[model samples]
Target chain A: MTIKLHCFGESGNAYKVALALELAGLDWQPVFVDFFNGETRTEDWRARVNPMGEVPVLQDGDMTLTQSGAMLDHIARTTGKLDGDRSEILRWLFWDNHKFSTQIGMTRFLMNFLPEAKRPQPVIDFQLGRLKAAYGVLDAQLKGRDWLVGRDVTIADLSCCGYLYYPEPFGFDRADWPEIDRWLNNIQSLPGWKHPYDLMPRAAAA
Target chain B: MTIKLHCFGESGNAYKVALALELAGLDWQPVFVDFFNGETRTEDWRARVNPMGEVPVLQDGDMTLTQSGAMLDHIARTTGKLDGDRSEILRWLFWDNHKFSTQIGMTRFLMNFLPEAKRPQPVIDFQLGRLKAAYGVLDAQLKGRDWLVGRDVTIADLSCCGYLYYPEPFGFDRADWPEIDRWLNNIQSLPGWKHPYDLMPRAAAA
Candidate 1:
């Protein structure tokens, strides 16, 4: 049976799972969630789809999974290719969720998705400052290593690169960190790689 | 050799690991990090300890691990308790890291740690709003359940409960969310439970 991913193009969290699915060569398809229209917030959607009210839910027959980090773990375990030091992979994934991707997702939403007049300037500035600190750690970690763990590309790589490919300004400039720049290039060079927009059903389908 | 956890009282991240260690019956000790004095970010501290410049690093002989979520997993696996549905456990762990604990940590820092005049009101307000939504999800999930995943208590509970115990003002009141409040009580009533300040050496102690 083909796996179904409930996702949206604008969601980097969704993109992380999508990237892992594509790279693993899984039989999967995207079912876009109209996040911008508040579909996920609806009571019916929450009860039936995911009570957590988050996207990128993977439907594998009777089994359903949410959280991109957990989804990546499922994919890696099933395929046995992306697995690395379990603790290390989880460390980076948790860090990305805690510090990196979460900050960028909200920062980008404020900077690009919110109406110009409604944008909270103070919140954006605060998030941008935090993002810089997170980026510094990631870039420095990548300086002497080819992968996040003692490995060739793991889910940590797929997880951290989730929000960086979007054109929207989230205070992230690849050119600003040479190590991250090279790492991005390395991920881009992988076979069967696709940008988030190219791989998922976009919110507006533009 | 005893497991060494580099932590401080103010860090709820470290508290998650500390709780896991105590419950798992692991012999461990907390080595304080002077976060309030900017020790984690100094060049020497970063070089010698965690390059990520963060606390809650677990040093067990030749193996060292960072990230509280991962540290919990290590403790759980090593001691053979607190394990549950892998994907479900991870989902809540990620949600706690991405939305619950991280938001509270920052909001509390802004509200309590920063000088009164330096606090950014708008940022605090925005984060408070986001935190309310996260708390709603958690409270609803715990409406009839005693734990975050499965029938037994797991690291997910430990992870999500990390920041809720702090006395600092981050706009959270246990009375406001009955389910979450009850769930917190459950965790607190666990055997060998200790407050974060009691479990770890405080920053001011230095």
Candidate 2:
């Protein structure tokens, strides 16, 4: 059965699941959601697709799953790939959702997607500060390790690296954090790894 | 063996785990972490306690667990309580971390905990807007449901209701959200349920 991922290219959250599917060599297809046009916010879409008004929804046969973390877990568990120390993997996944990727996703959107005049400077600045702290934590965790969790790459790595591959400037620079830079390189070196835009159909103009 | 939860009263993240432990009828003790006094931010604490530099660290004999969502899962699994449809429970837990509690936690800290002069209006306004959207999603999910996941209350309920129980204003009013309000009442009605402040030792003055 083909796993259908409802996603847009601009969404790192969606990209996390897409990357997992690709790396795990699962049979999957991308169904682009027109998120930029407020499709997700509409009552019809929310009622039919996801009431949370978020993307990265995965439909595998009778199961429809939202929340990229949950989707990643599902992929890892079902495929027996990207699986690691369960507790460690889950810890990083929760942290990424709570502190890392969530901040980066919003910050990137505010910095790049929003109109220049409408961009909230103070909010961006605050997010940048928070993101910096989160980056420090990530870099520190990666200081003497190859993967965020166990001895091998896991869903934890995929979850944390969700927004790092983006070209948009969201107050993050690879050169600034050598640990994260090297970690990103490690992820990029994986077989079948593809840039998010190459892997998913993008809704926003490049 | 007794479980030791490193937490403080002000942290809603910690409250999630605390509430789960209490409701599960586990023999647990709260080892207060002085969050406001910069304990979690210390180098020693980060290295020794949690590299993520966050709270709700649970220790049971040889195992040390961080991340409230993961801890909730651990509690539910080990105690045979608050466990339900694994996928549905995880979906809501991820959503709560990514959208609901994280925003409310930060917004509440800025609005009430921070010095009035140091509060950034734009950041607070932005977070309030995001929090409102999250509240709408949660309220809509609870429209005709007694719990967030499954037929009975699970960690999903504990996770989402973490920040909602806090007295600090984070632009969330239970009165404005009737469904969430009623759902909260259902949680409060659960035996052994305690307010966050009551369940944990608070570092801040009430």
Candidate 3:
């Protein structure tokens, strides 16, 4: 059976999986979960796929998978893109998912989605601090490098771009991160990057 | 030259890389970074390796990798541990690093390490909500399953174990997560998992 990914419309997390499938040149069905109507929270939806009641769950025959990072890794490995120095590539991929994506993504989500009245300044400040701190580190790492791992693009670049390019939504200024900006531009120029973005125009708008 | 990883001595992030090196059975050098002294802030260090100024930067020959998720992916790819159904494995690994490891690890860290007076309840609440949400999803997925991916252990289990087992520090009651607890117990029994915890006496104490 072909792989089927269940996710919400225009969700960035879901887009990550879609992007990976495109990059790996795999054909899969996209099952939309209506987040606005709370479709993901239904018992039936939760039982068959995600218990967490979250979007972006990939069902491959009998095997099911969750988490965007894992999905990206799975796609890369399955498609033979997880090549080159194995250890080196895996390390960068982990970093992207764990550090850059986690911290920055959290900041972006909060600053963009949370209502001003509900959002606390300290929380915003704390996330921004972490984001800047992470940027500083990323800037240094990208000094002479074009990609997070190896000469060619790997899931590391794809994973990082899942959140890095949407800084404007989080109110982060990209001008401060030249290296990241250059890297983002490089990934955007890739052939695979455009496929999913074109299919989901609203996702890229964010 | 042997692979050199620069990181703080007592960091879980750093430990992720160290654990990968140990599991991969590769020879490497560990460079201790002084977090209290603010050594990560040095321009030289930032310029040469990570601009994020975080620990656990792995340098092999001329290639340096930052971000623990990326690092793990690199190691797995390089060491040939990324086995089984490639996409399946990669998906779980990414999920472990991005969702499970990232959320659980951060929640645990803040609750355990940060001073009570300085800890933010909302952040804790947010993380806790996310954690429980993730756990519910994982518990459902793990029902009648041995590991997150295939029948055997993969980087996905390793990555999740790095954070999931230490729920106490984060004020998380394992009783609430029977599946995760069961899985954690299983992983702890493994020789690979035990090796690092045994070597790091301090971690055992915590």
Scored by CA lDDT, what does every candidate get?
A: 0.90, 0.91, 0.68
Better of 1 and 2 by lDDT: 2
Computed on C-alpha atoms, the DockQ of candidate 2 is 0.81
Query: How would you encode candidate 2's per-residue C-alpha lDDT over B1-206 as one tens digit per residue?
Result: 99999999999999999999999999999998998999988999888877667787999899999889999988888888999988889999999999888888889999999999999998998888888888888898898899988799999999999988888788988899999999999999999899988899999889
- In model 2, the runs with Cα more than 4 Å from the true position are none
Candidate 3 DockQ category? medium
DockQ, ranked from best to worst: 1, 2, 3
DockQ of every predicted complex? 0.91, 0.81, 0.50
What's candidate 3's i-RMS value?
3.4
Candidate 3: tens digits of C-alpha lDDT, residues B54-78: 6668888878776676676667767
Q: Mind giving the per-residue lDDT tens digits that candidate 3 earns over A32-100?
A: 676656777799888777766767788877777777766766677677873456656566666666666
Against the hidden reference, what TM-scores do the models get? 0.97, 0.97, 0.76
lDDT, model 3, position B146: 76
Q: What share of the true interface contacts does each candidate keep?
A: 0.96, 0.75, 0.82
Question: In lDDT terms, how accurate is model 1?
Answer: 0.90
1 or 3: which has the higher TM-score?
A: 1
TM-score of chain A of each: 0.96, 0.97, 0.85
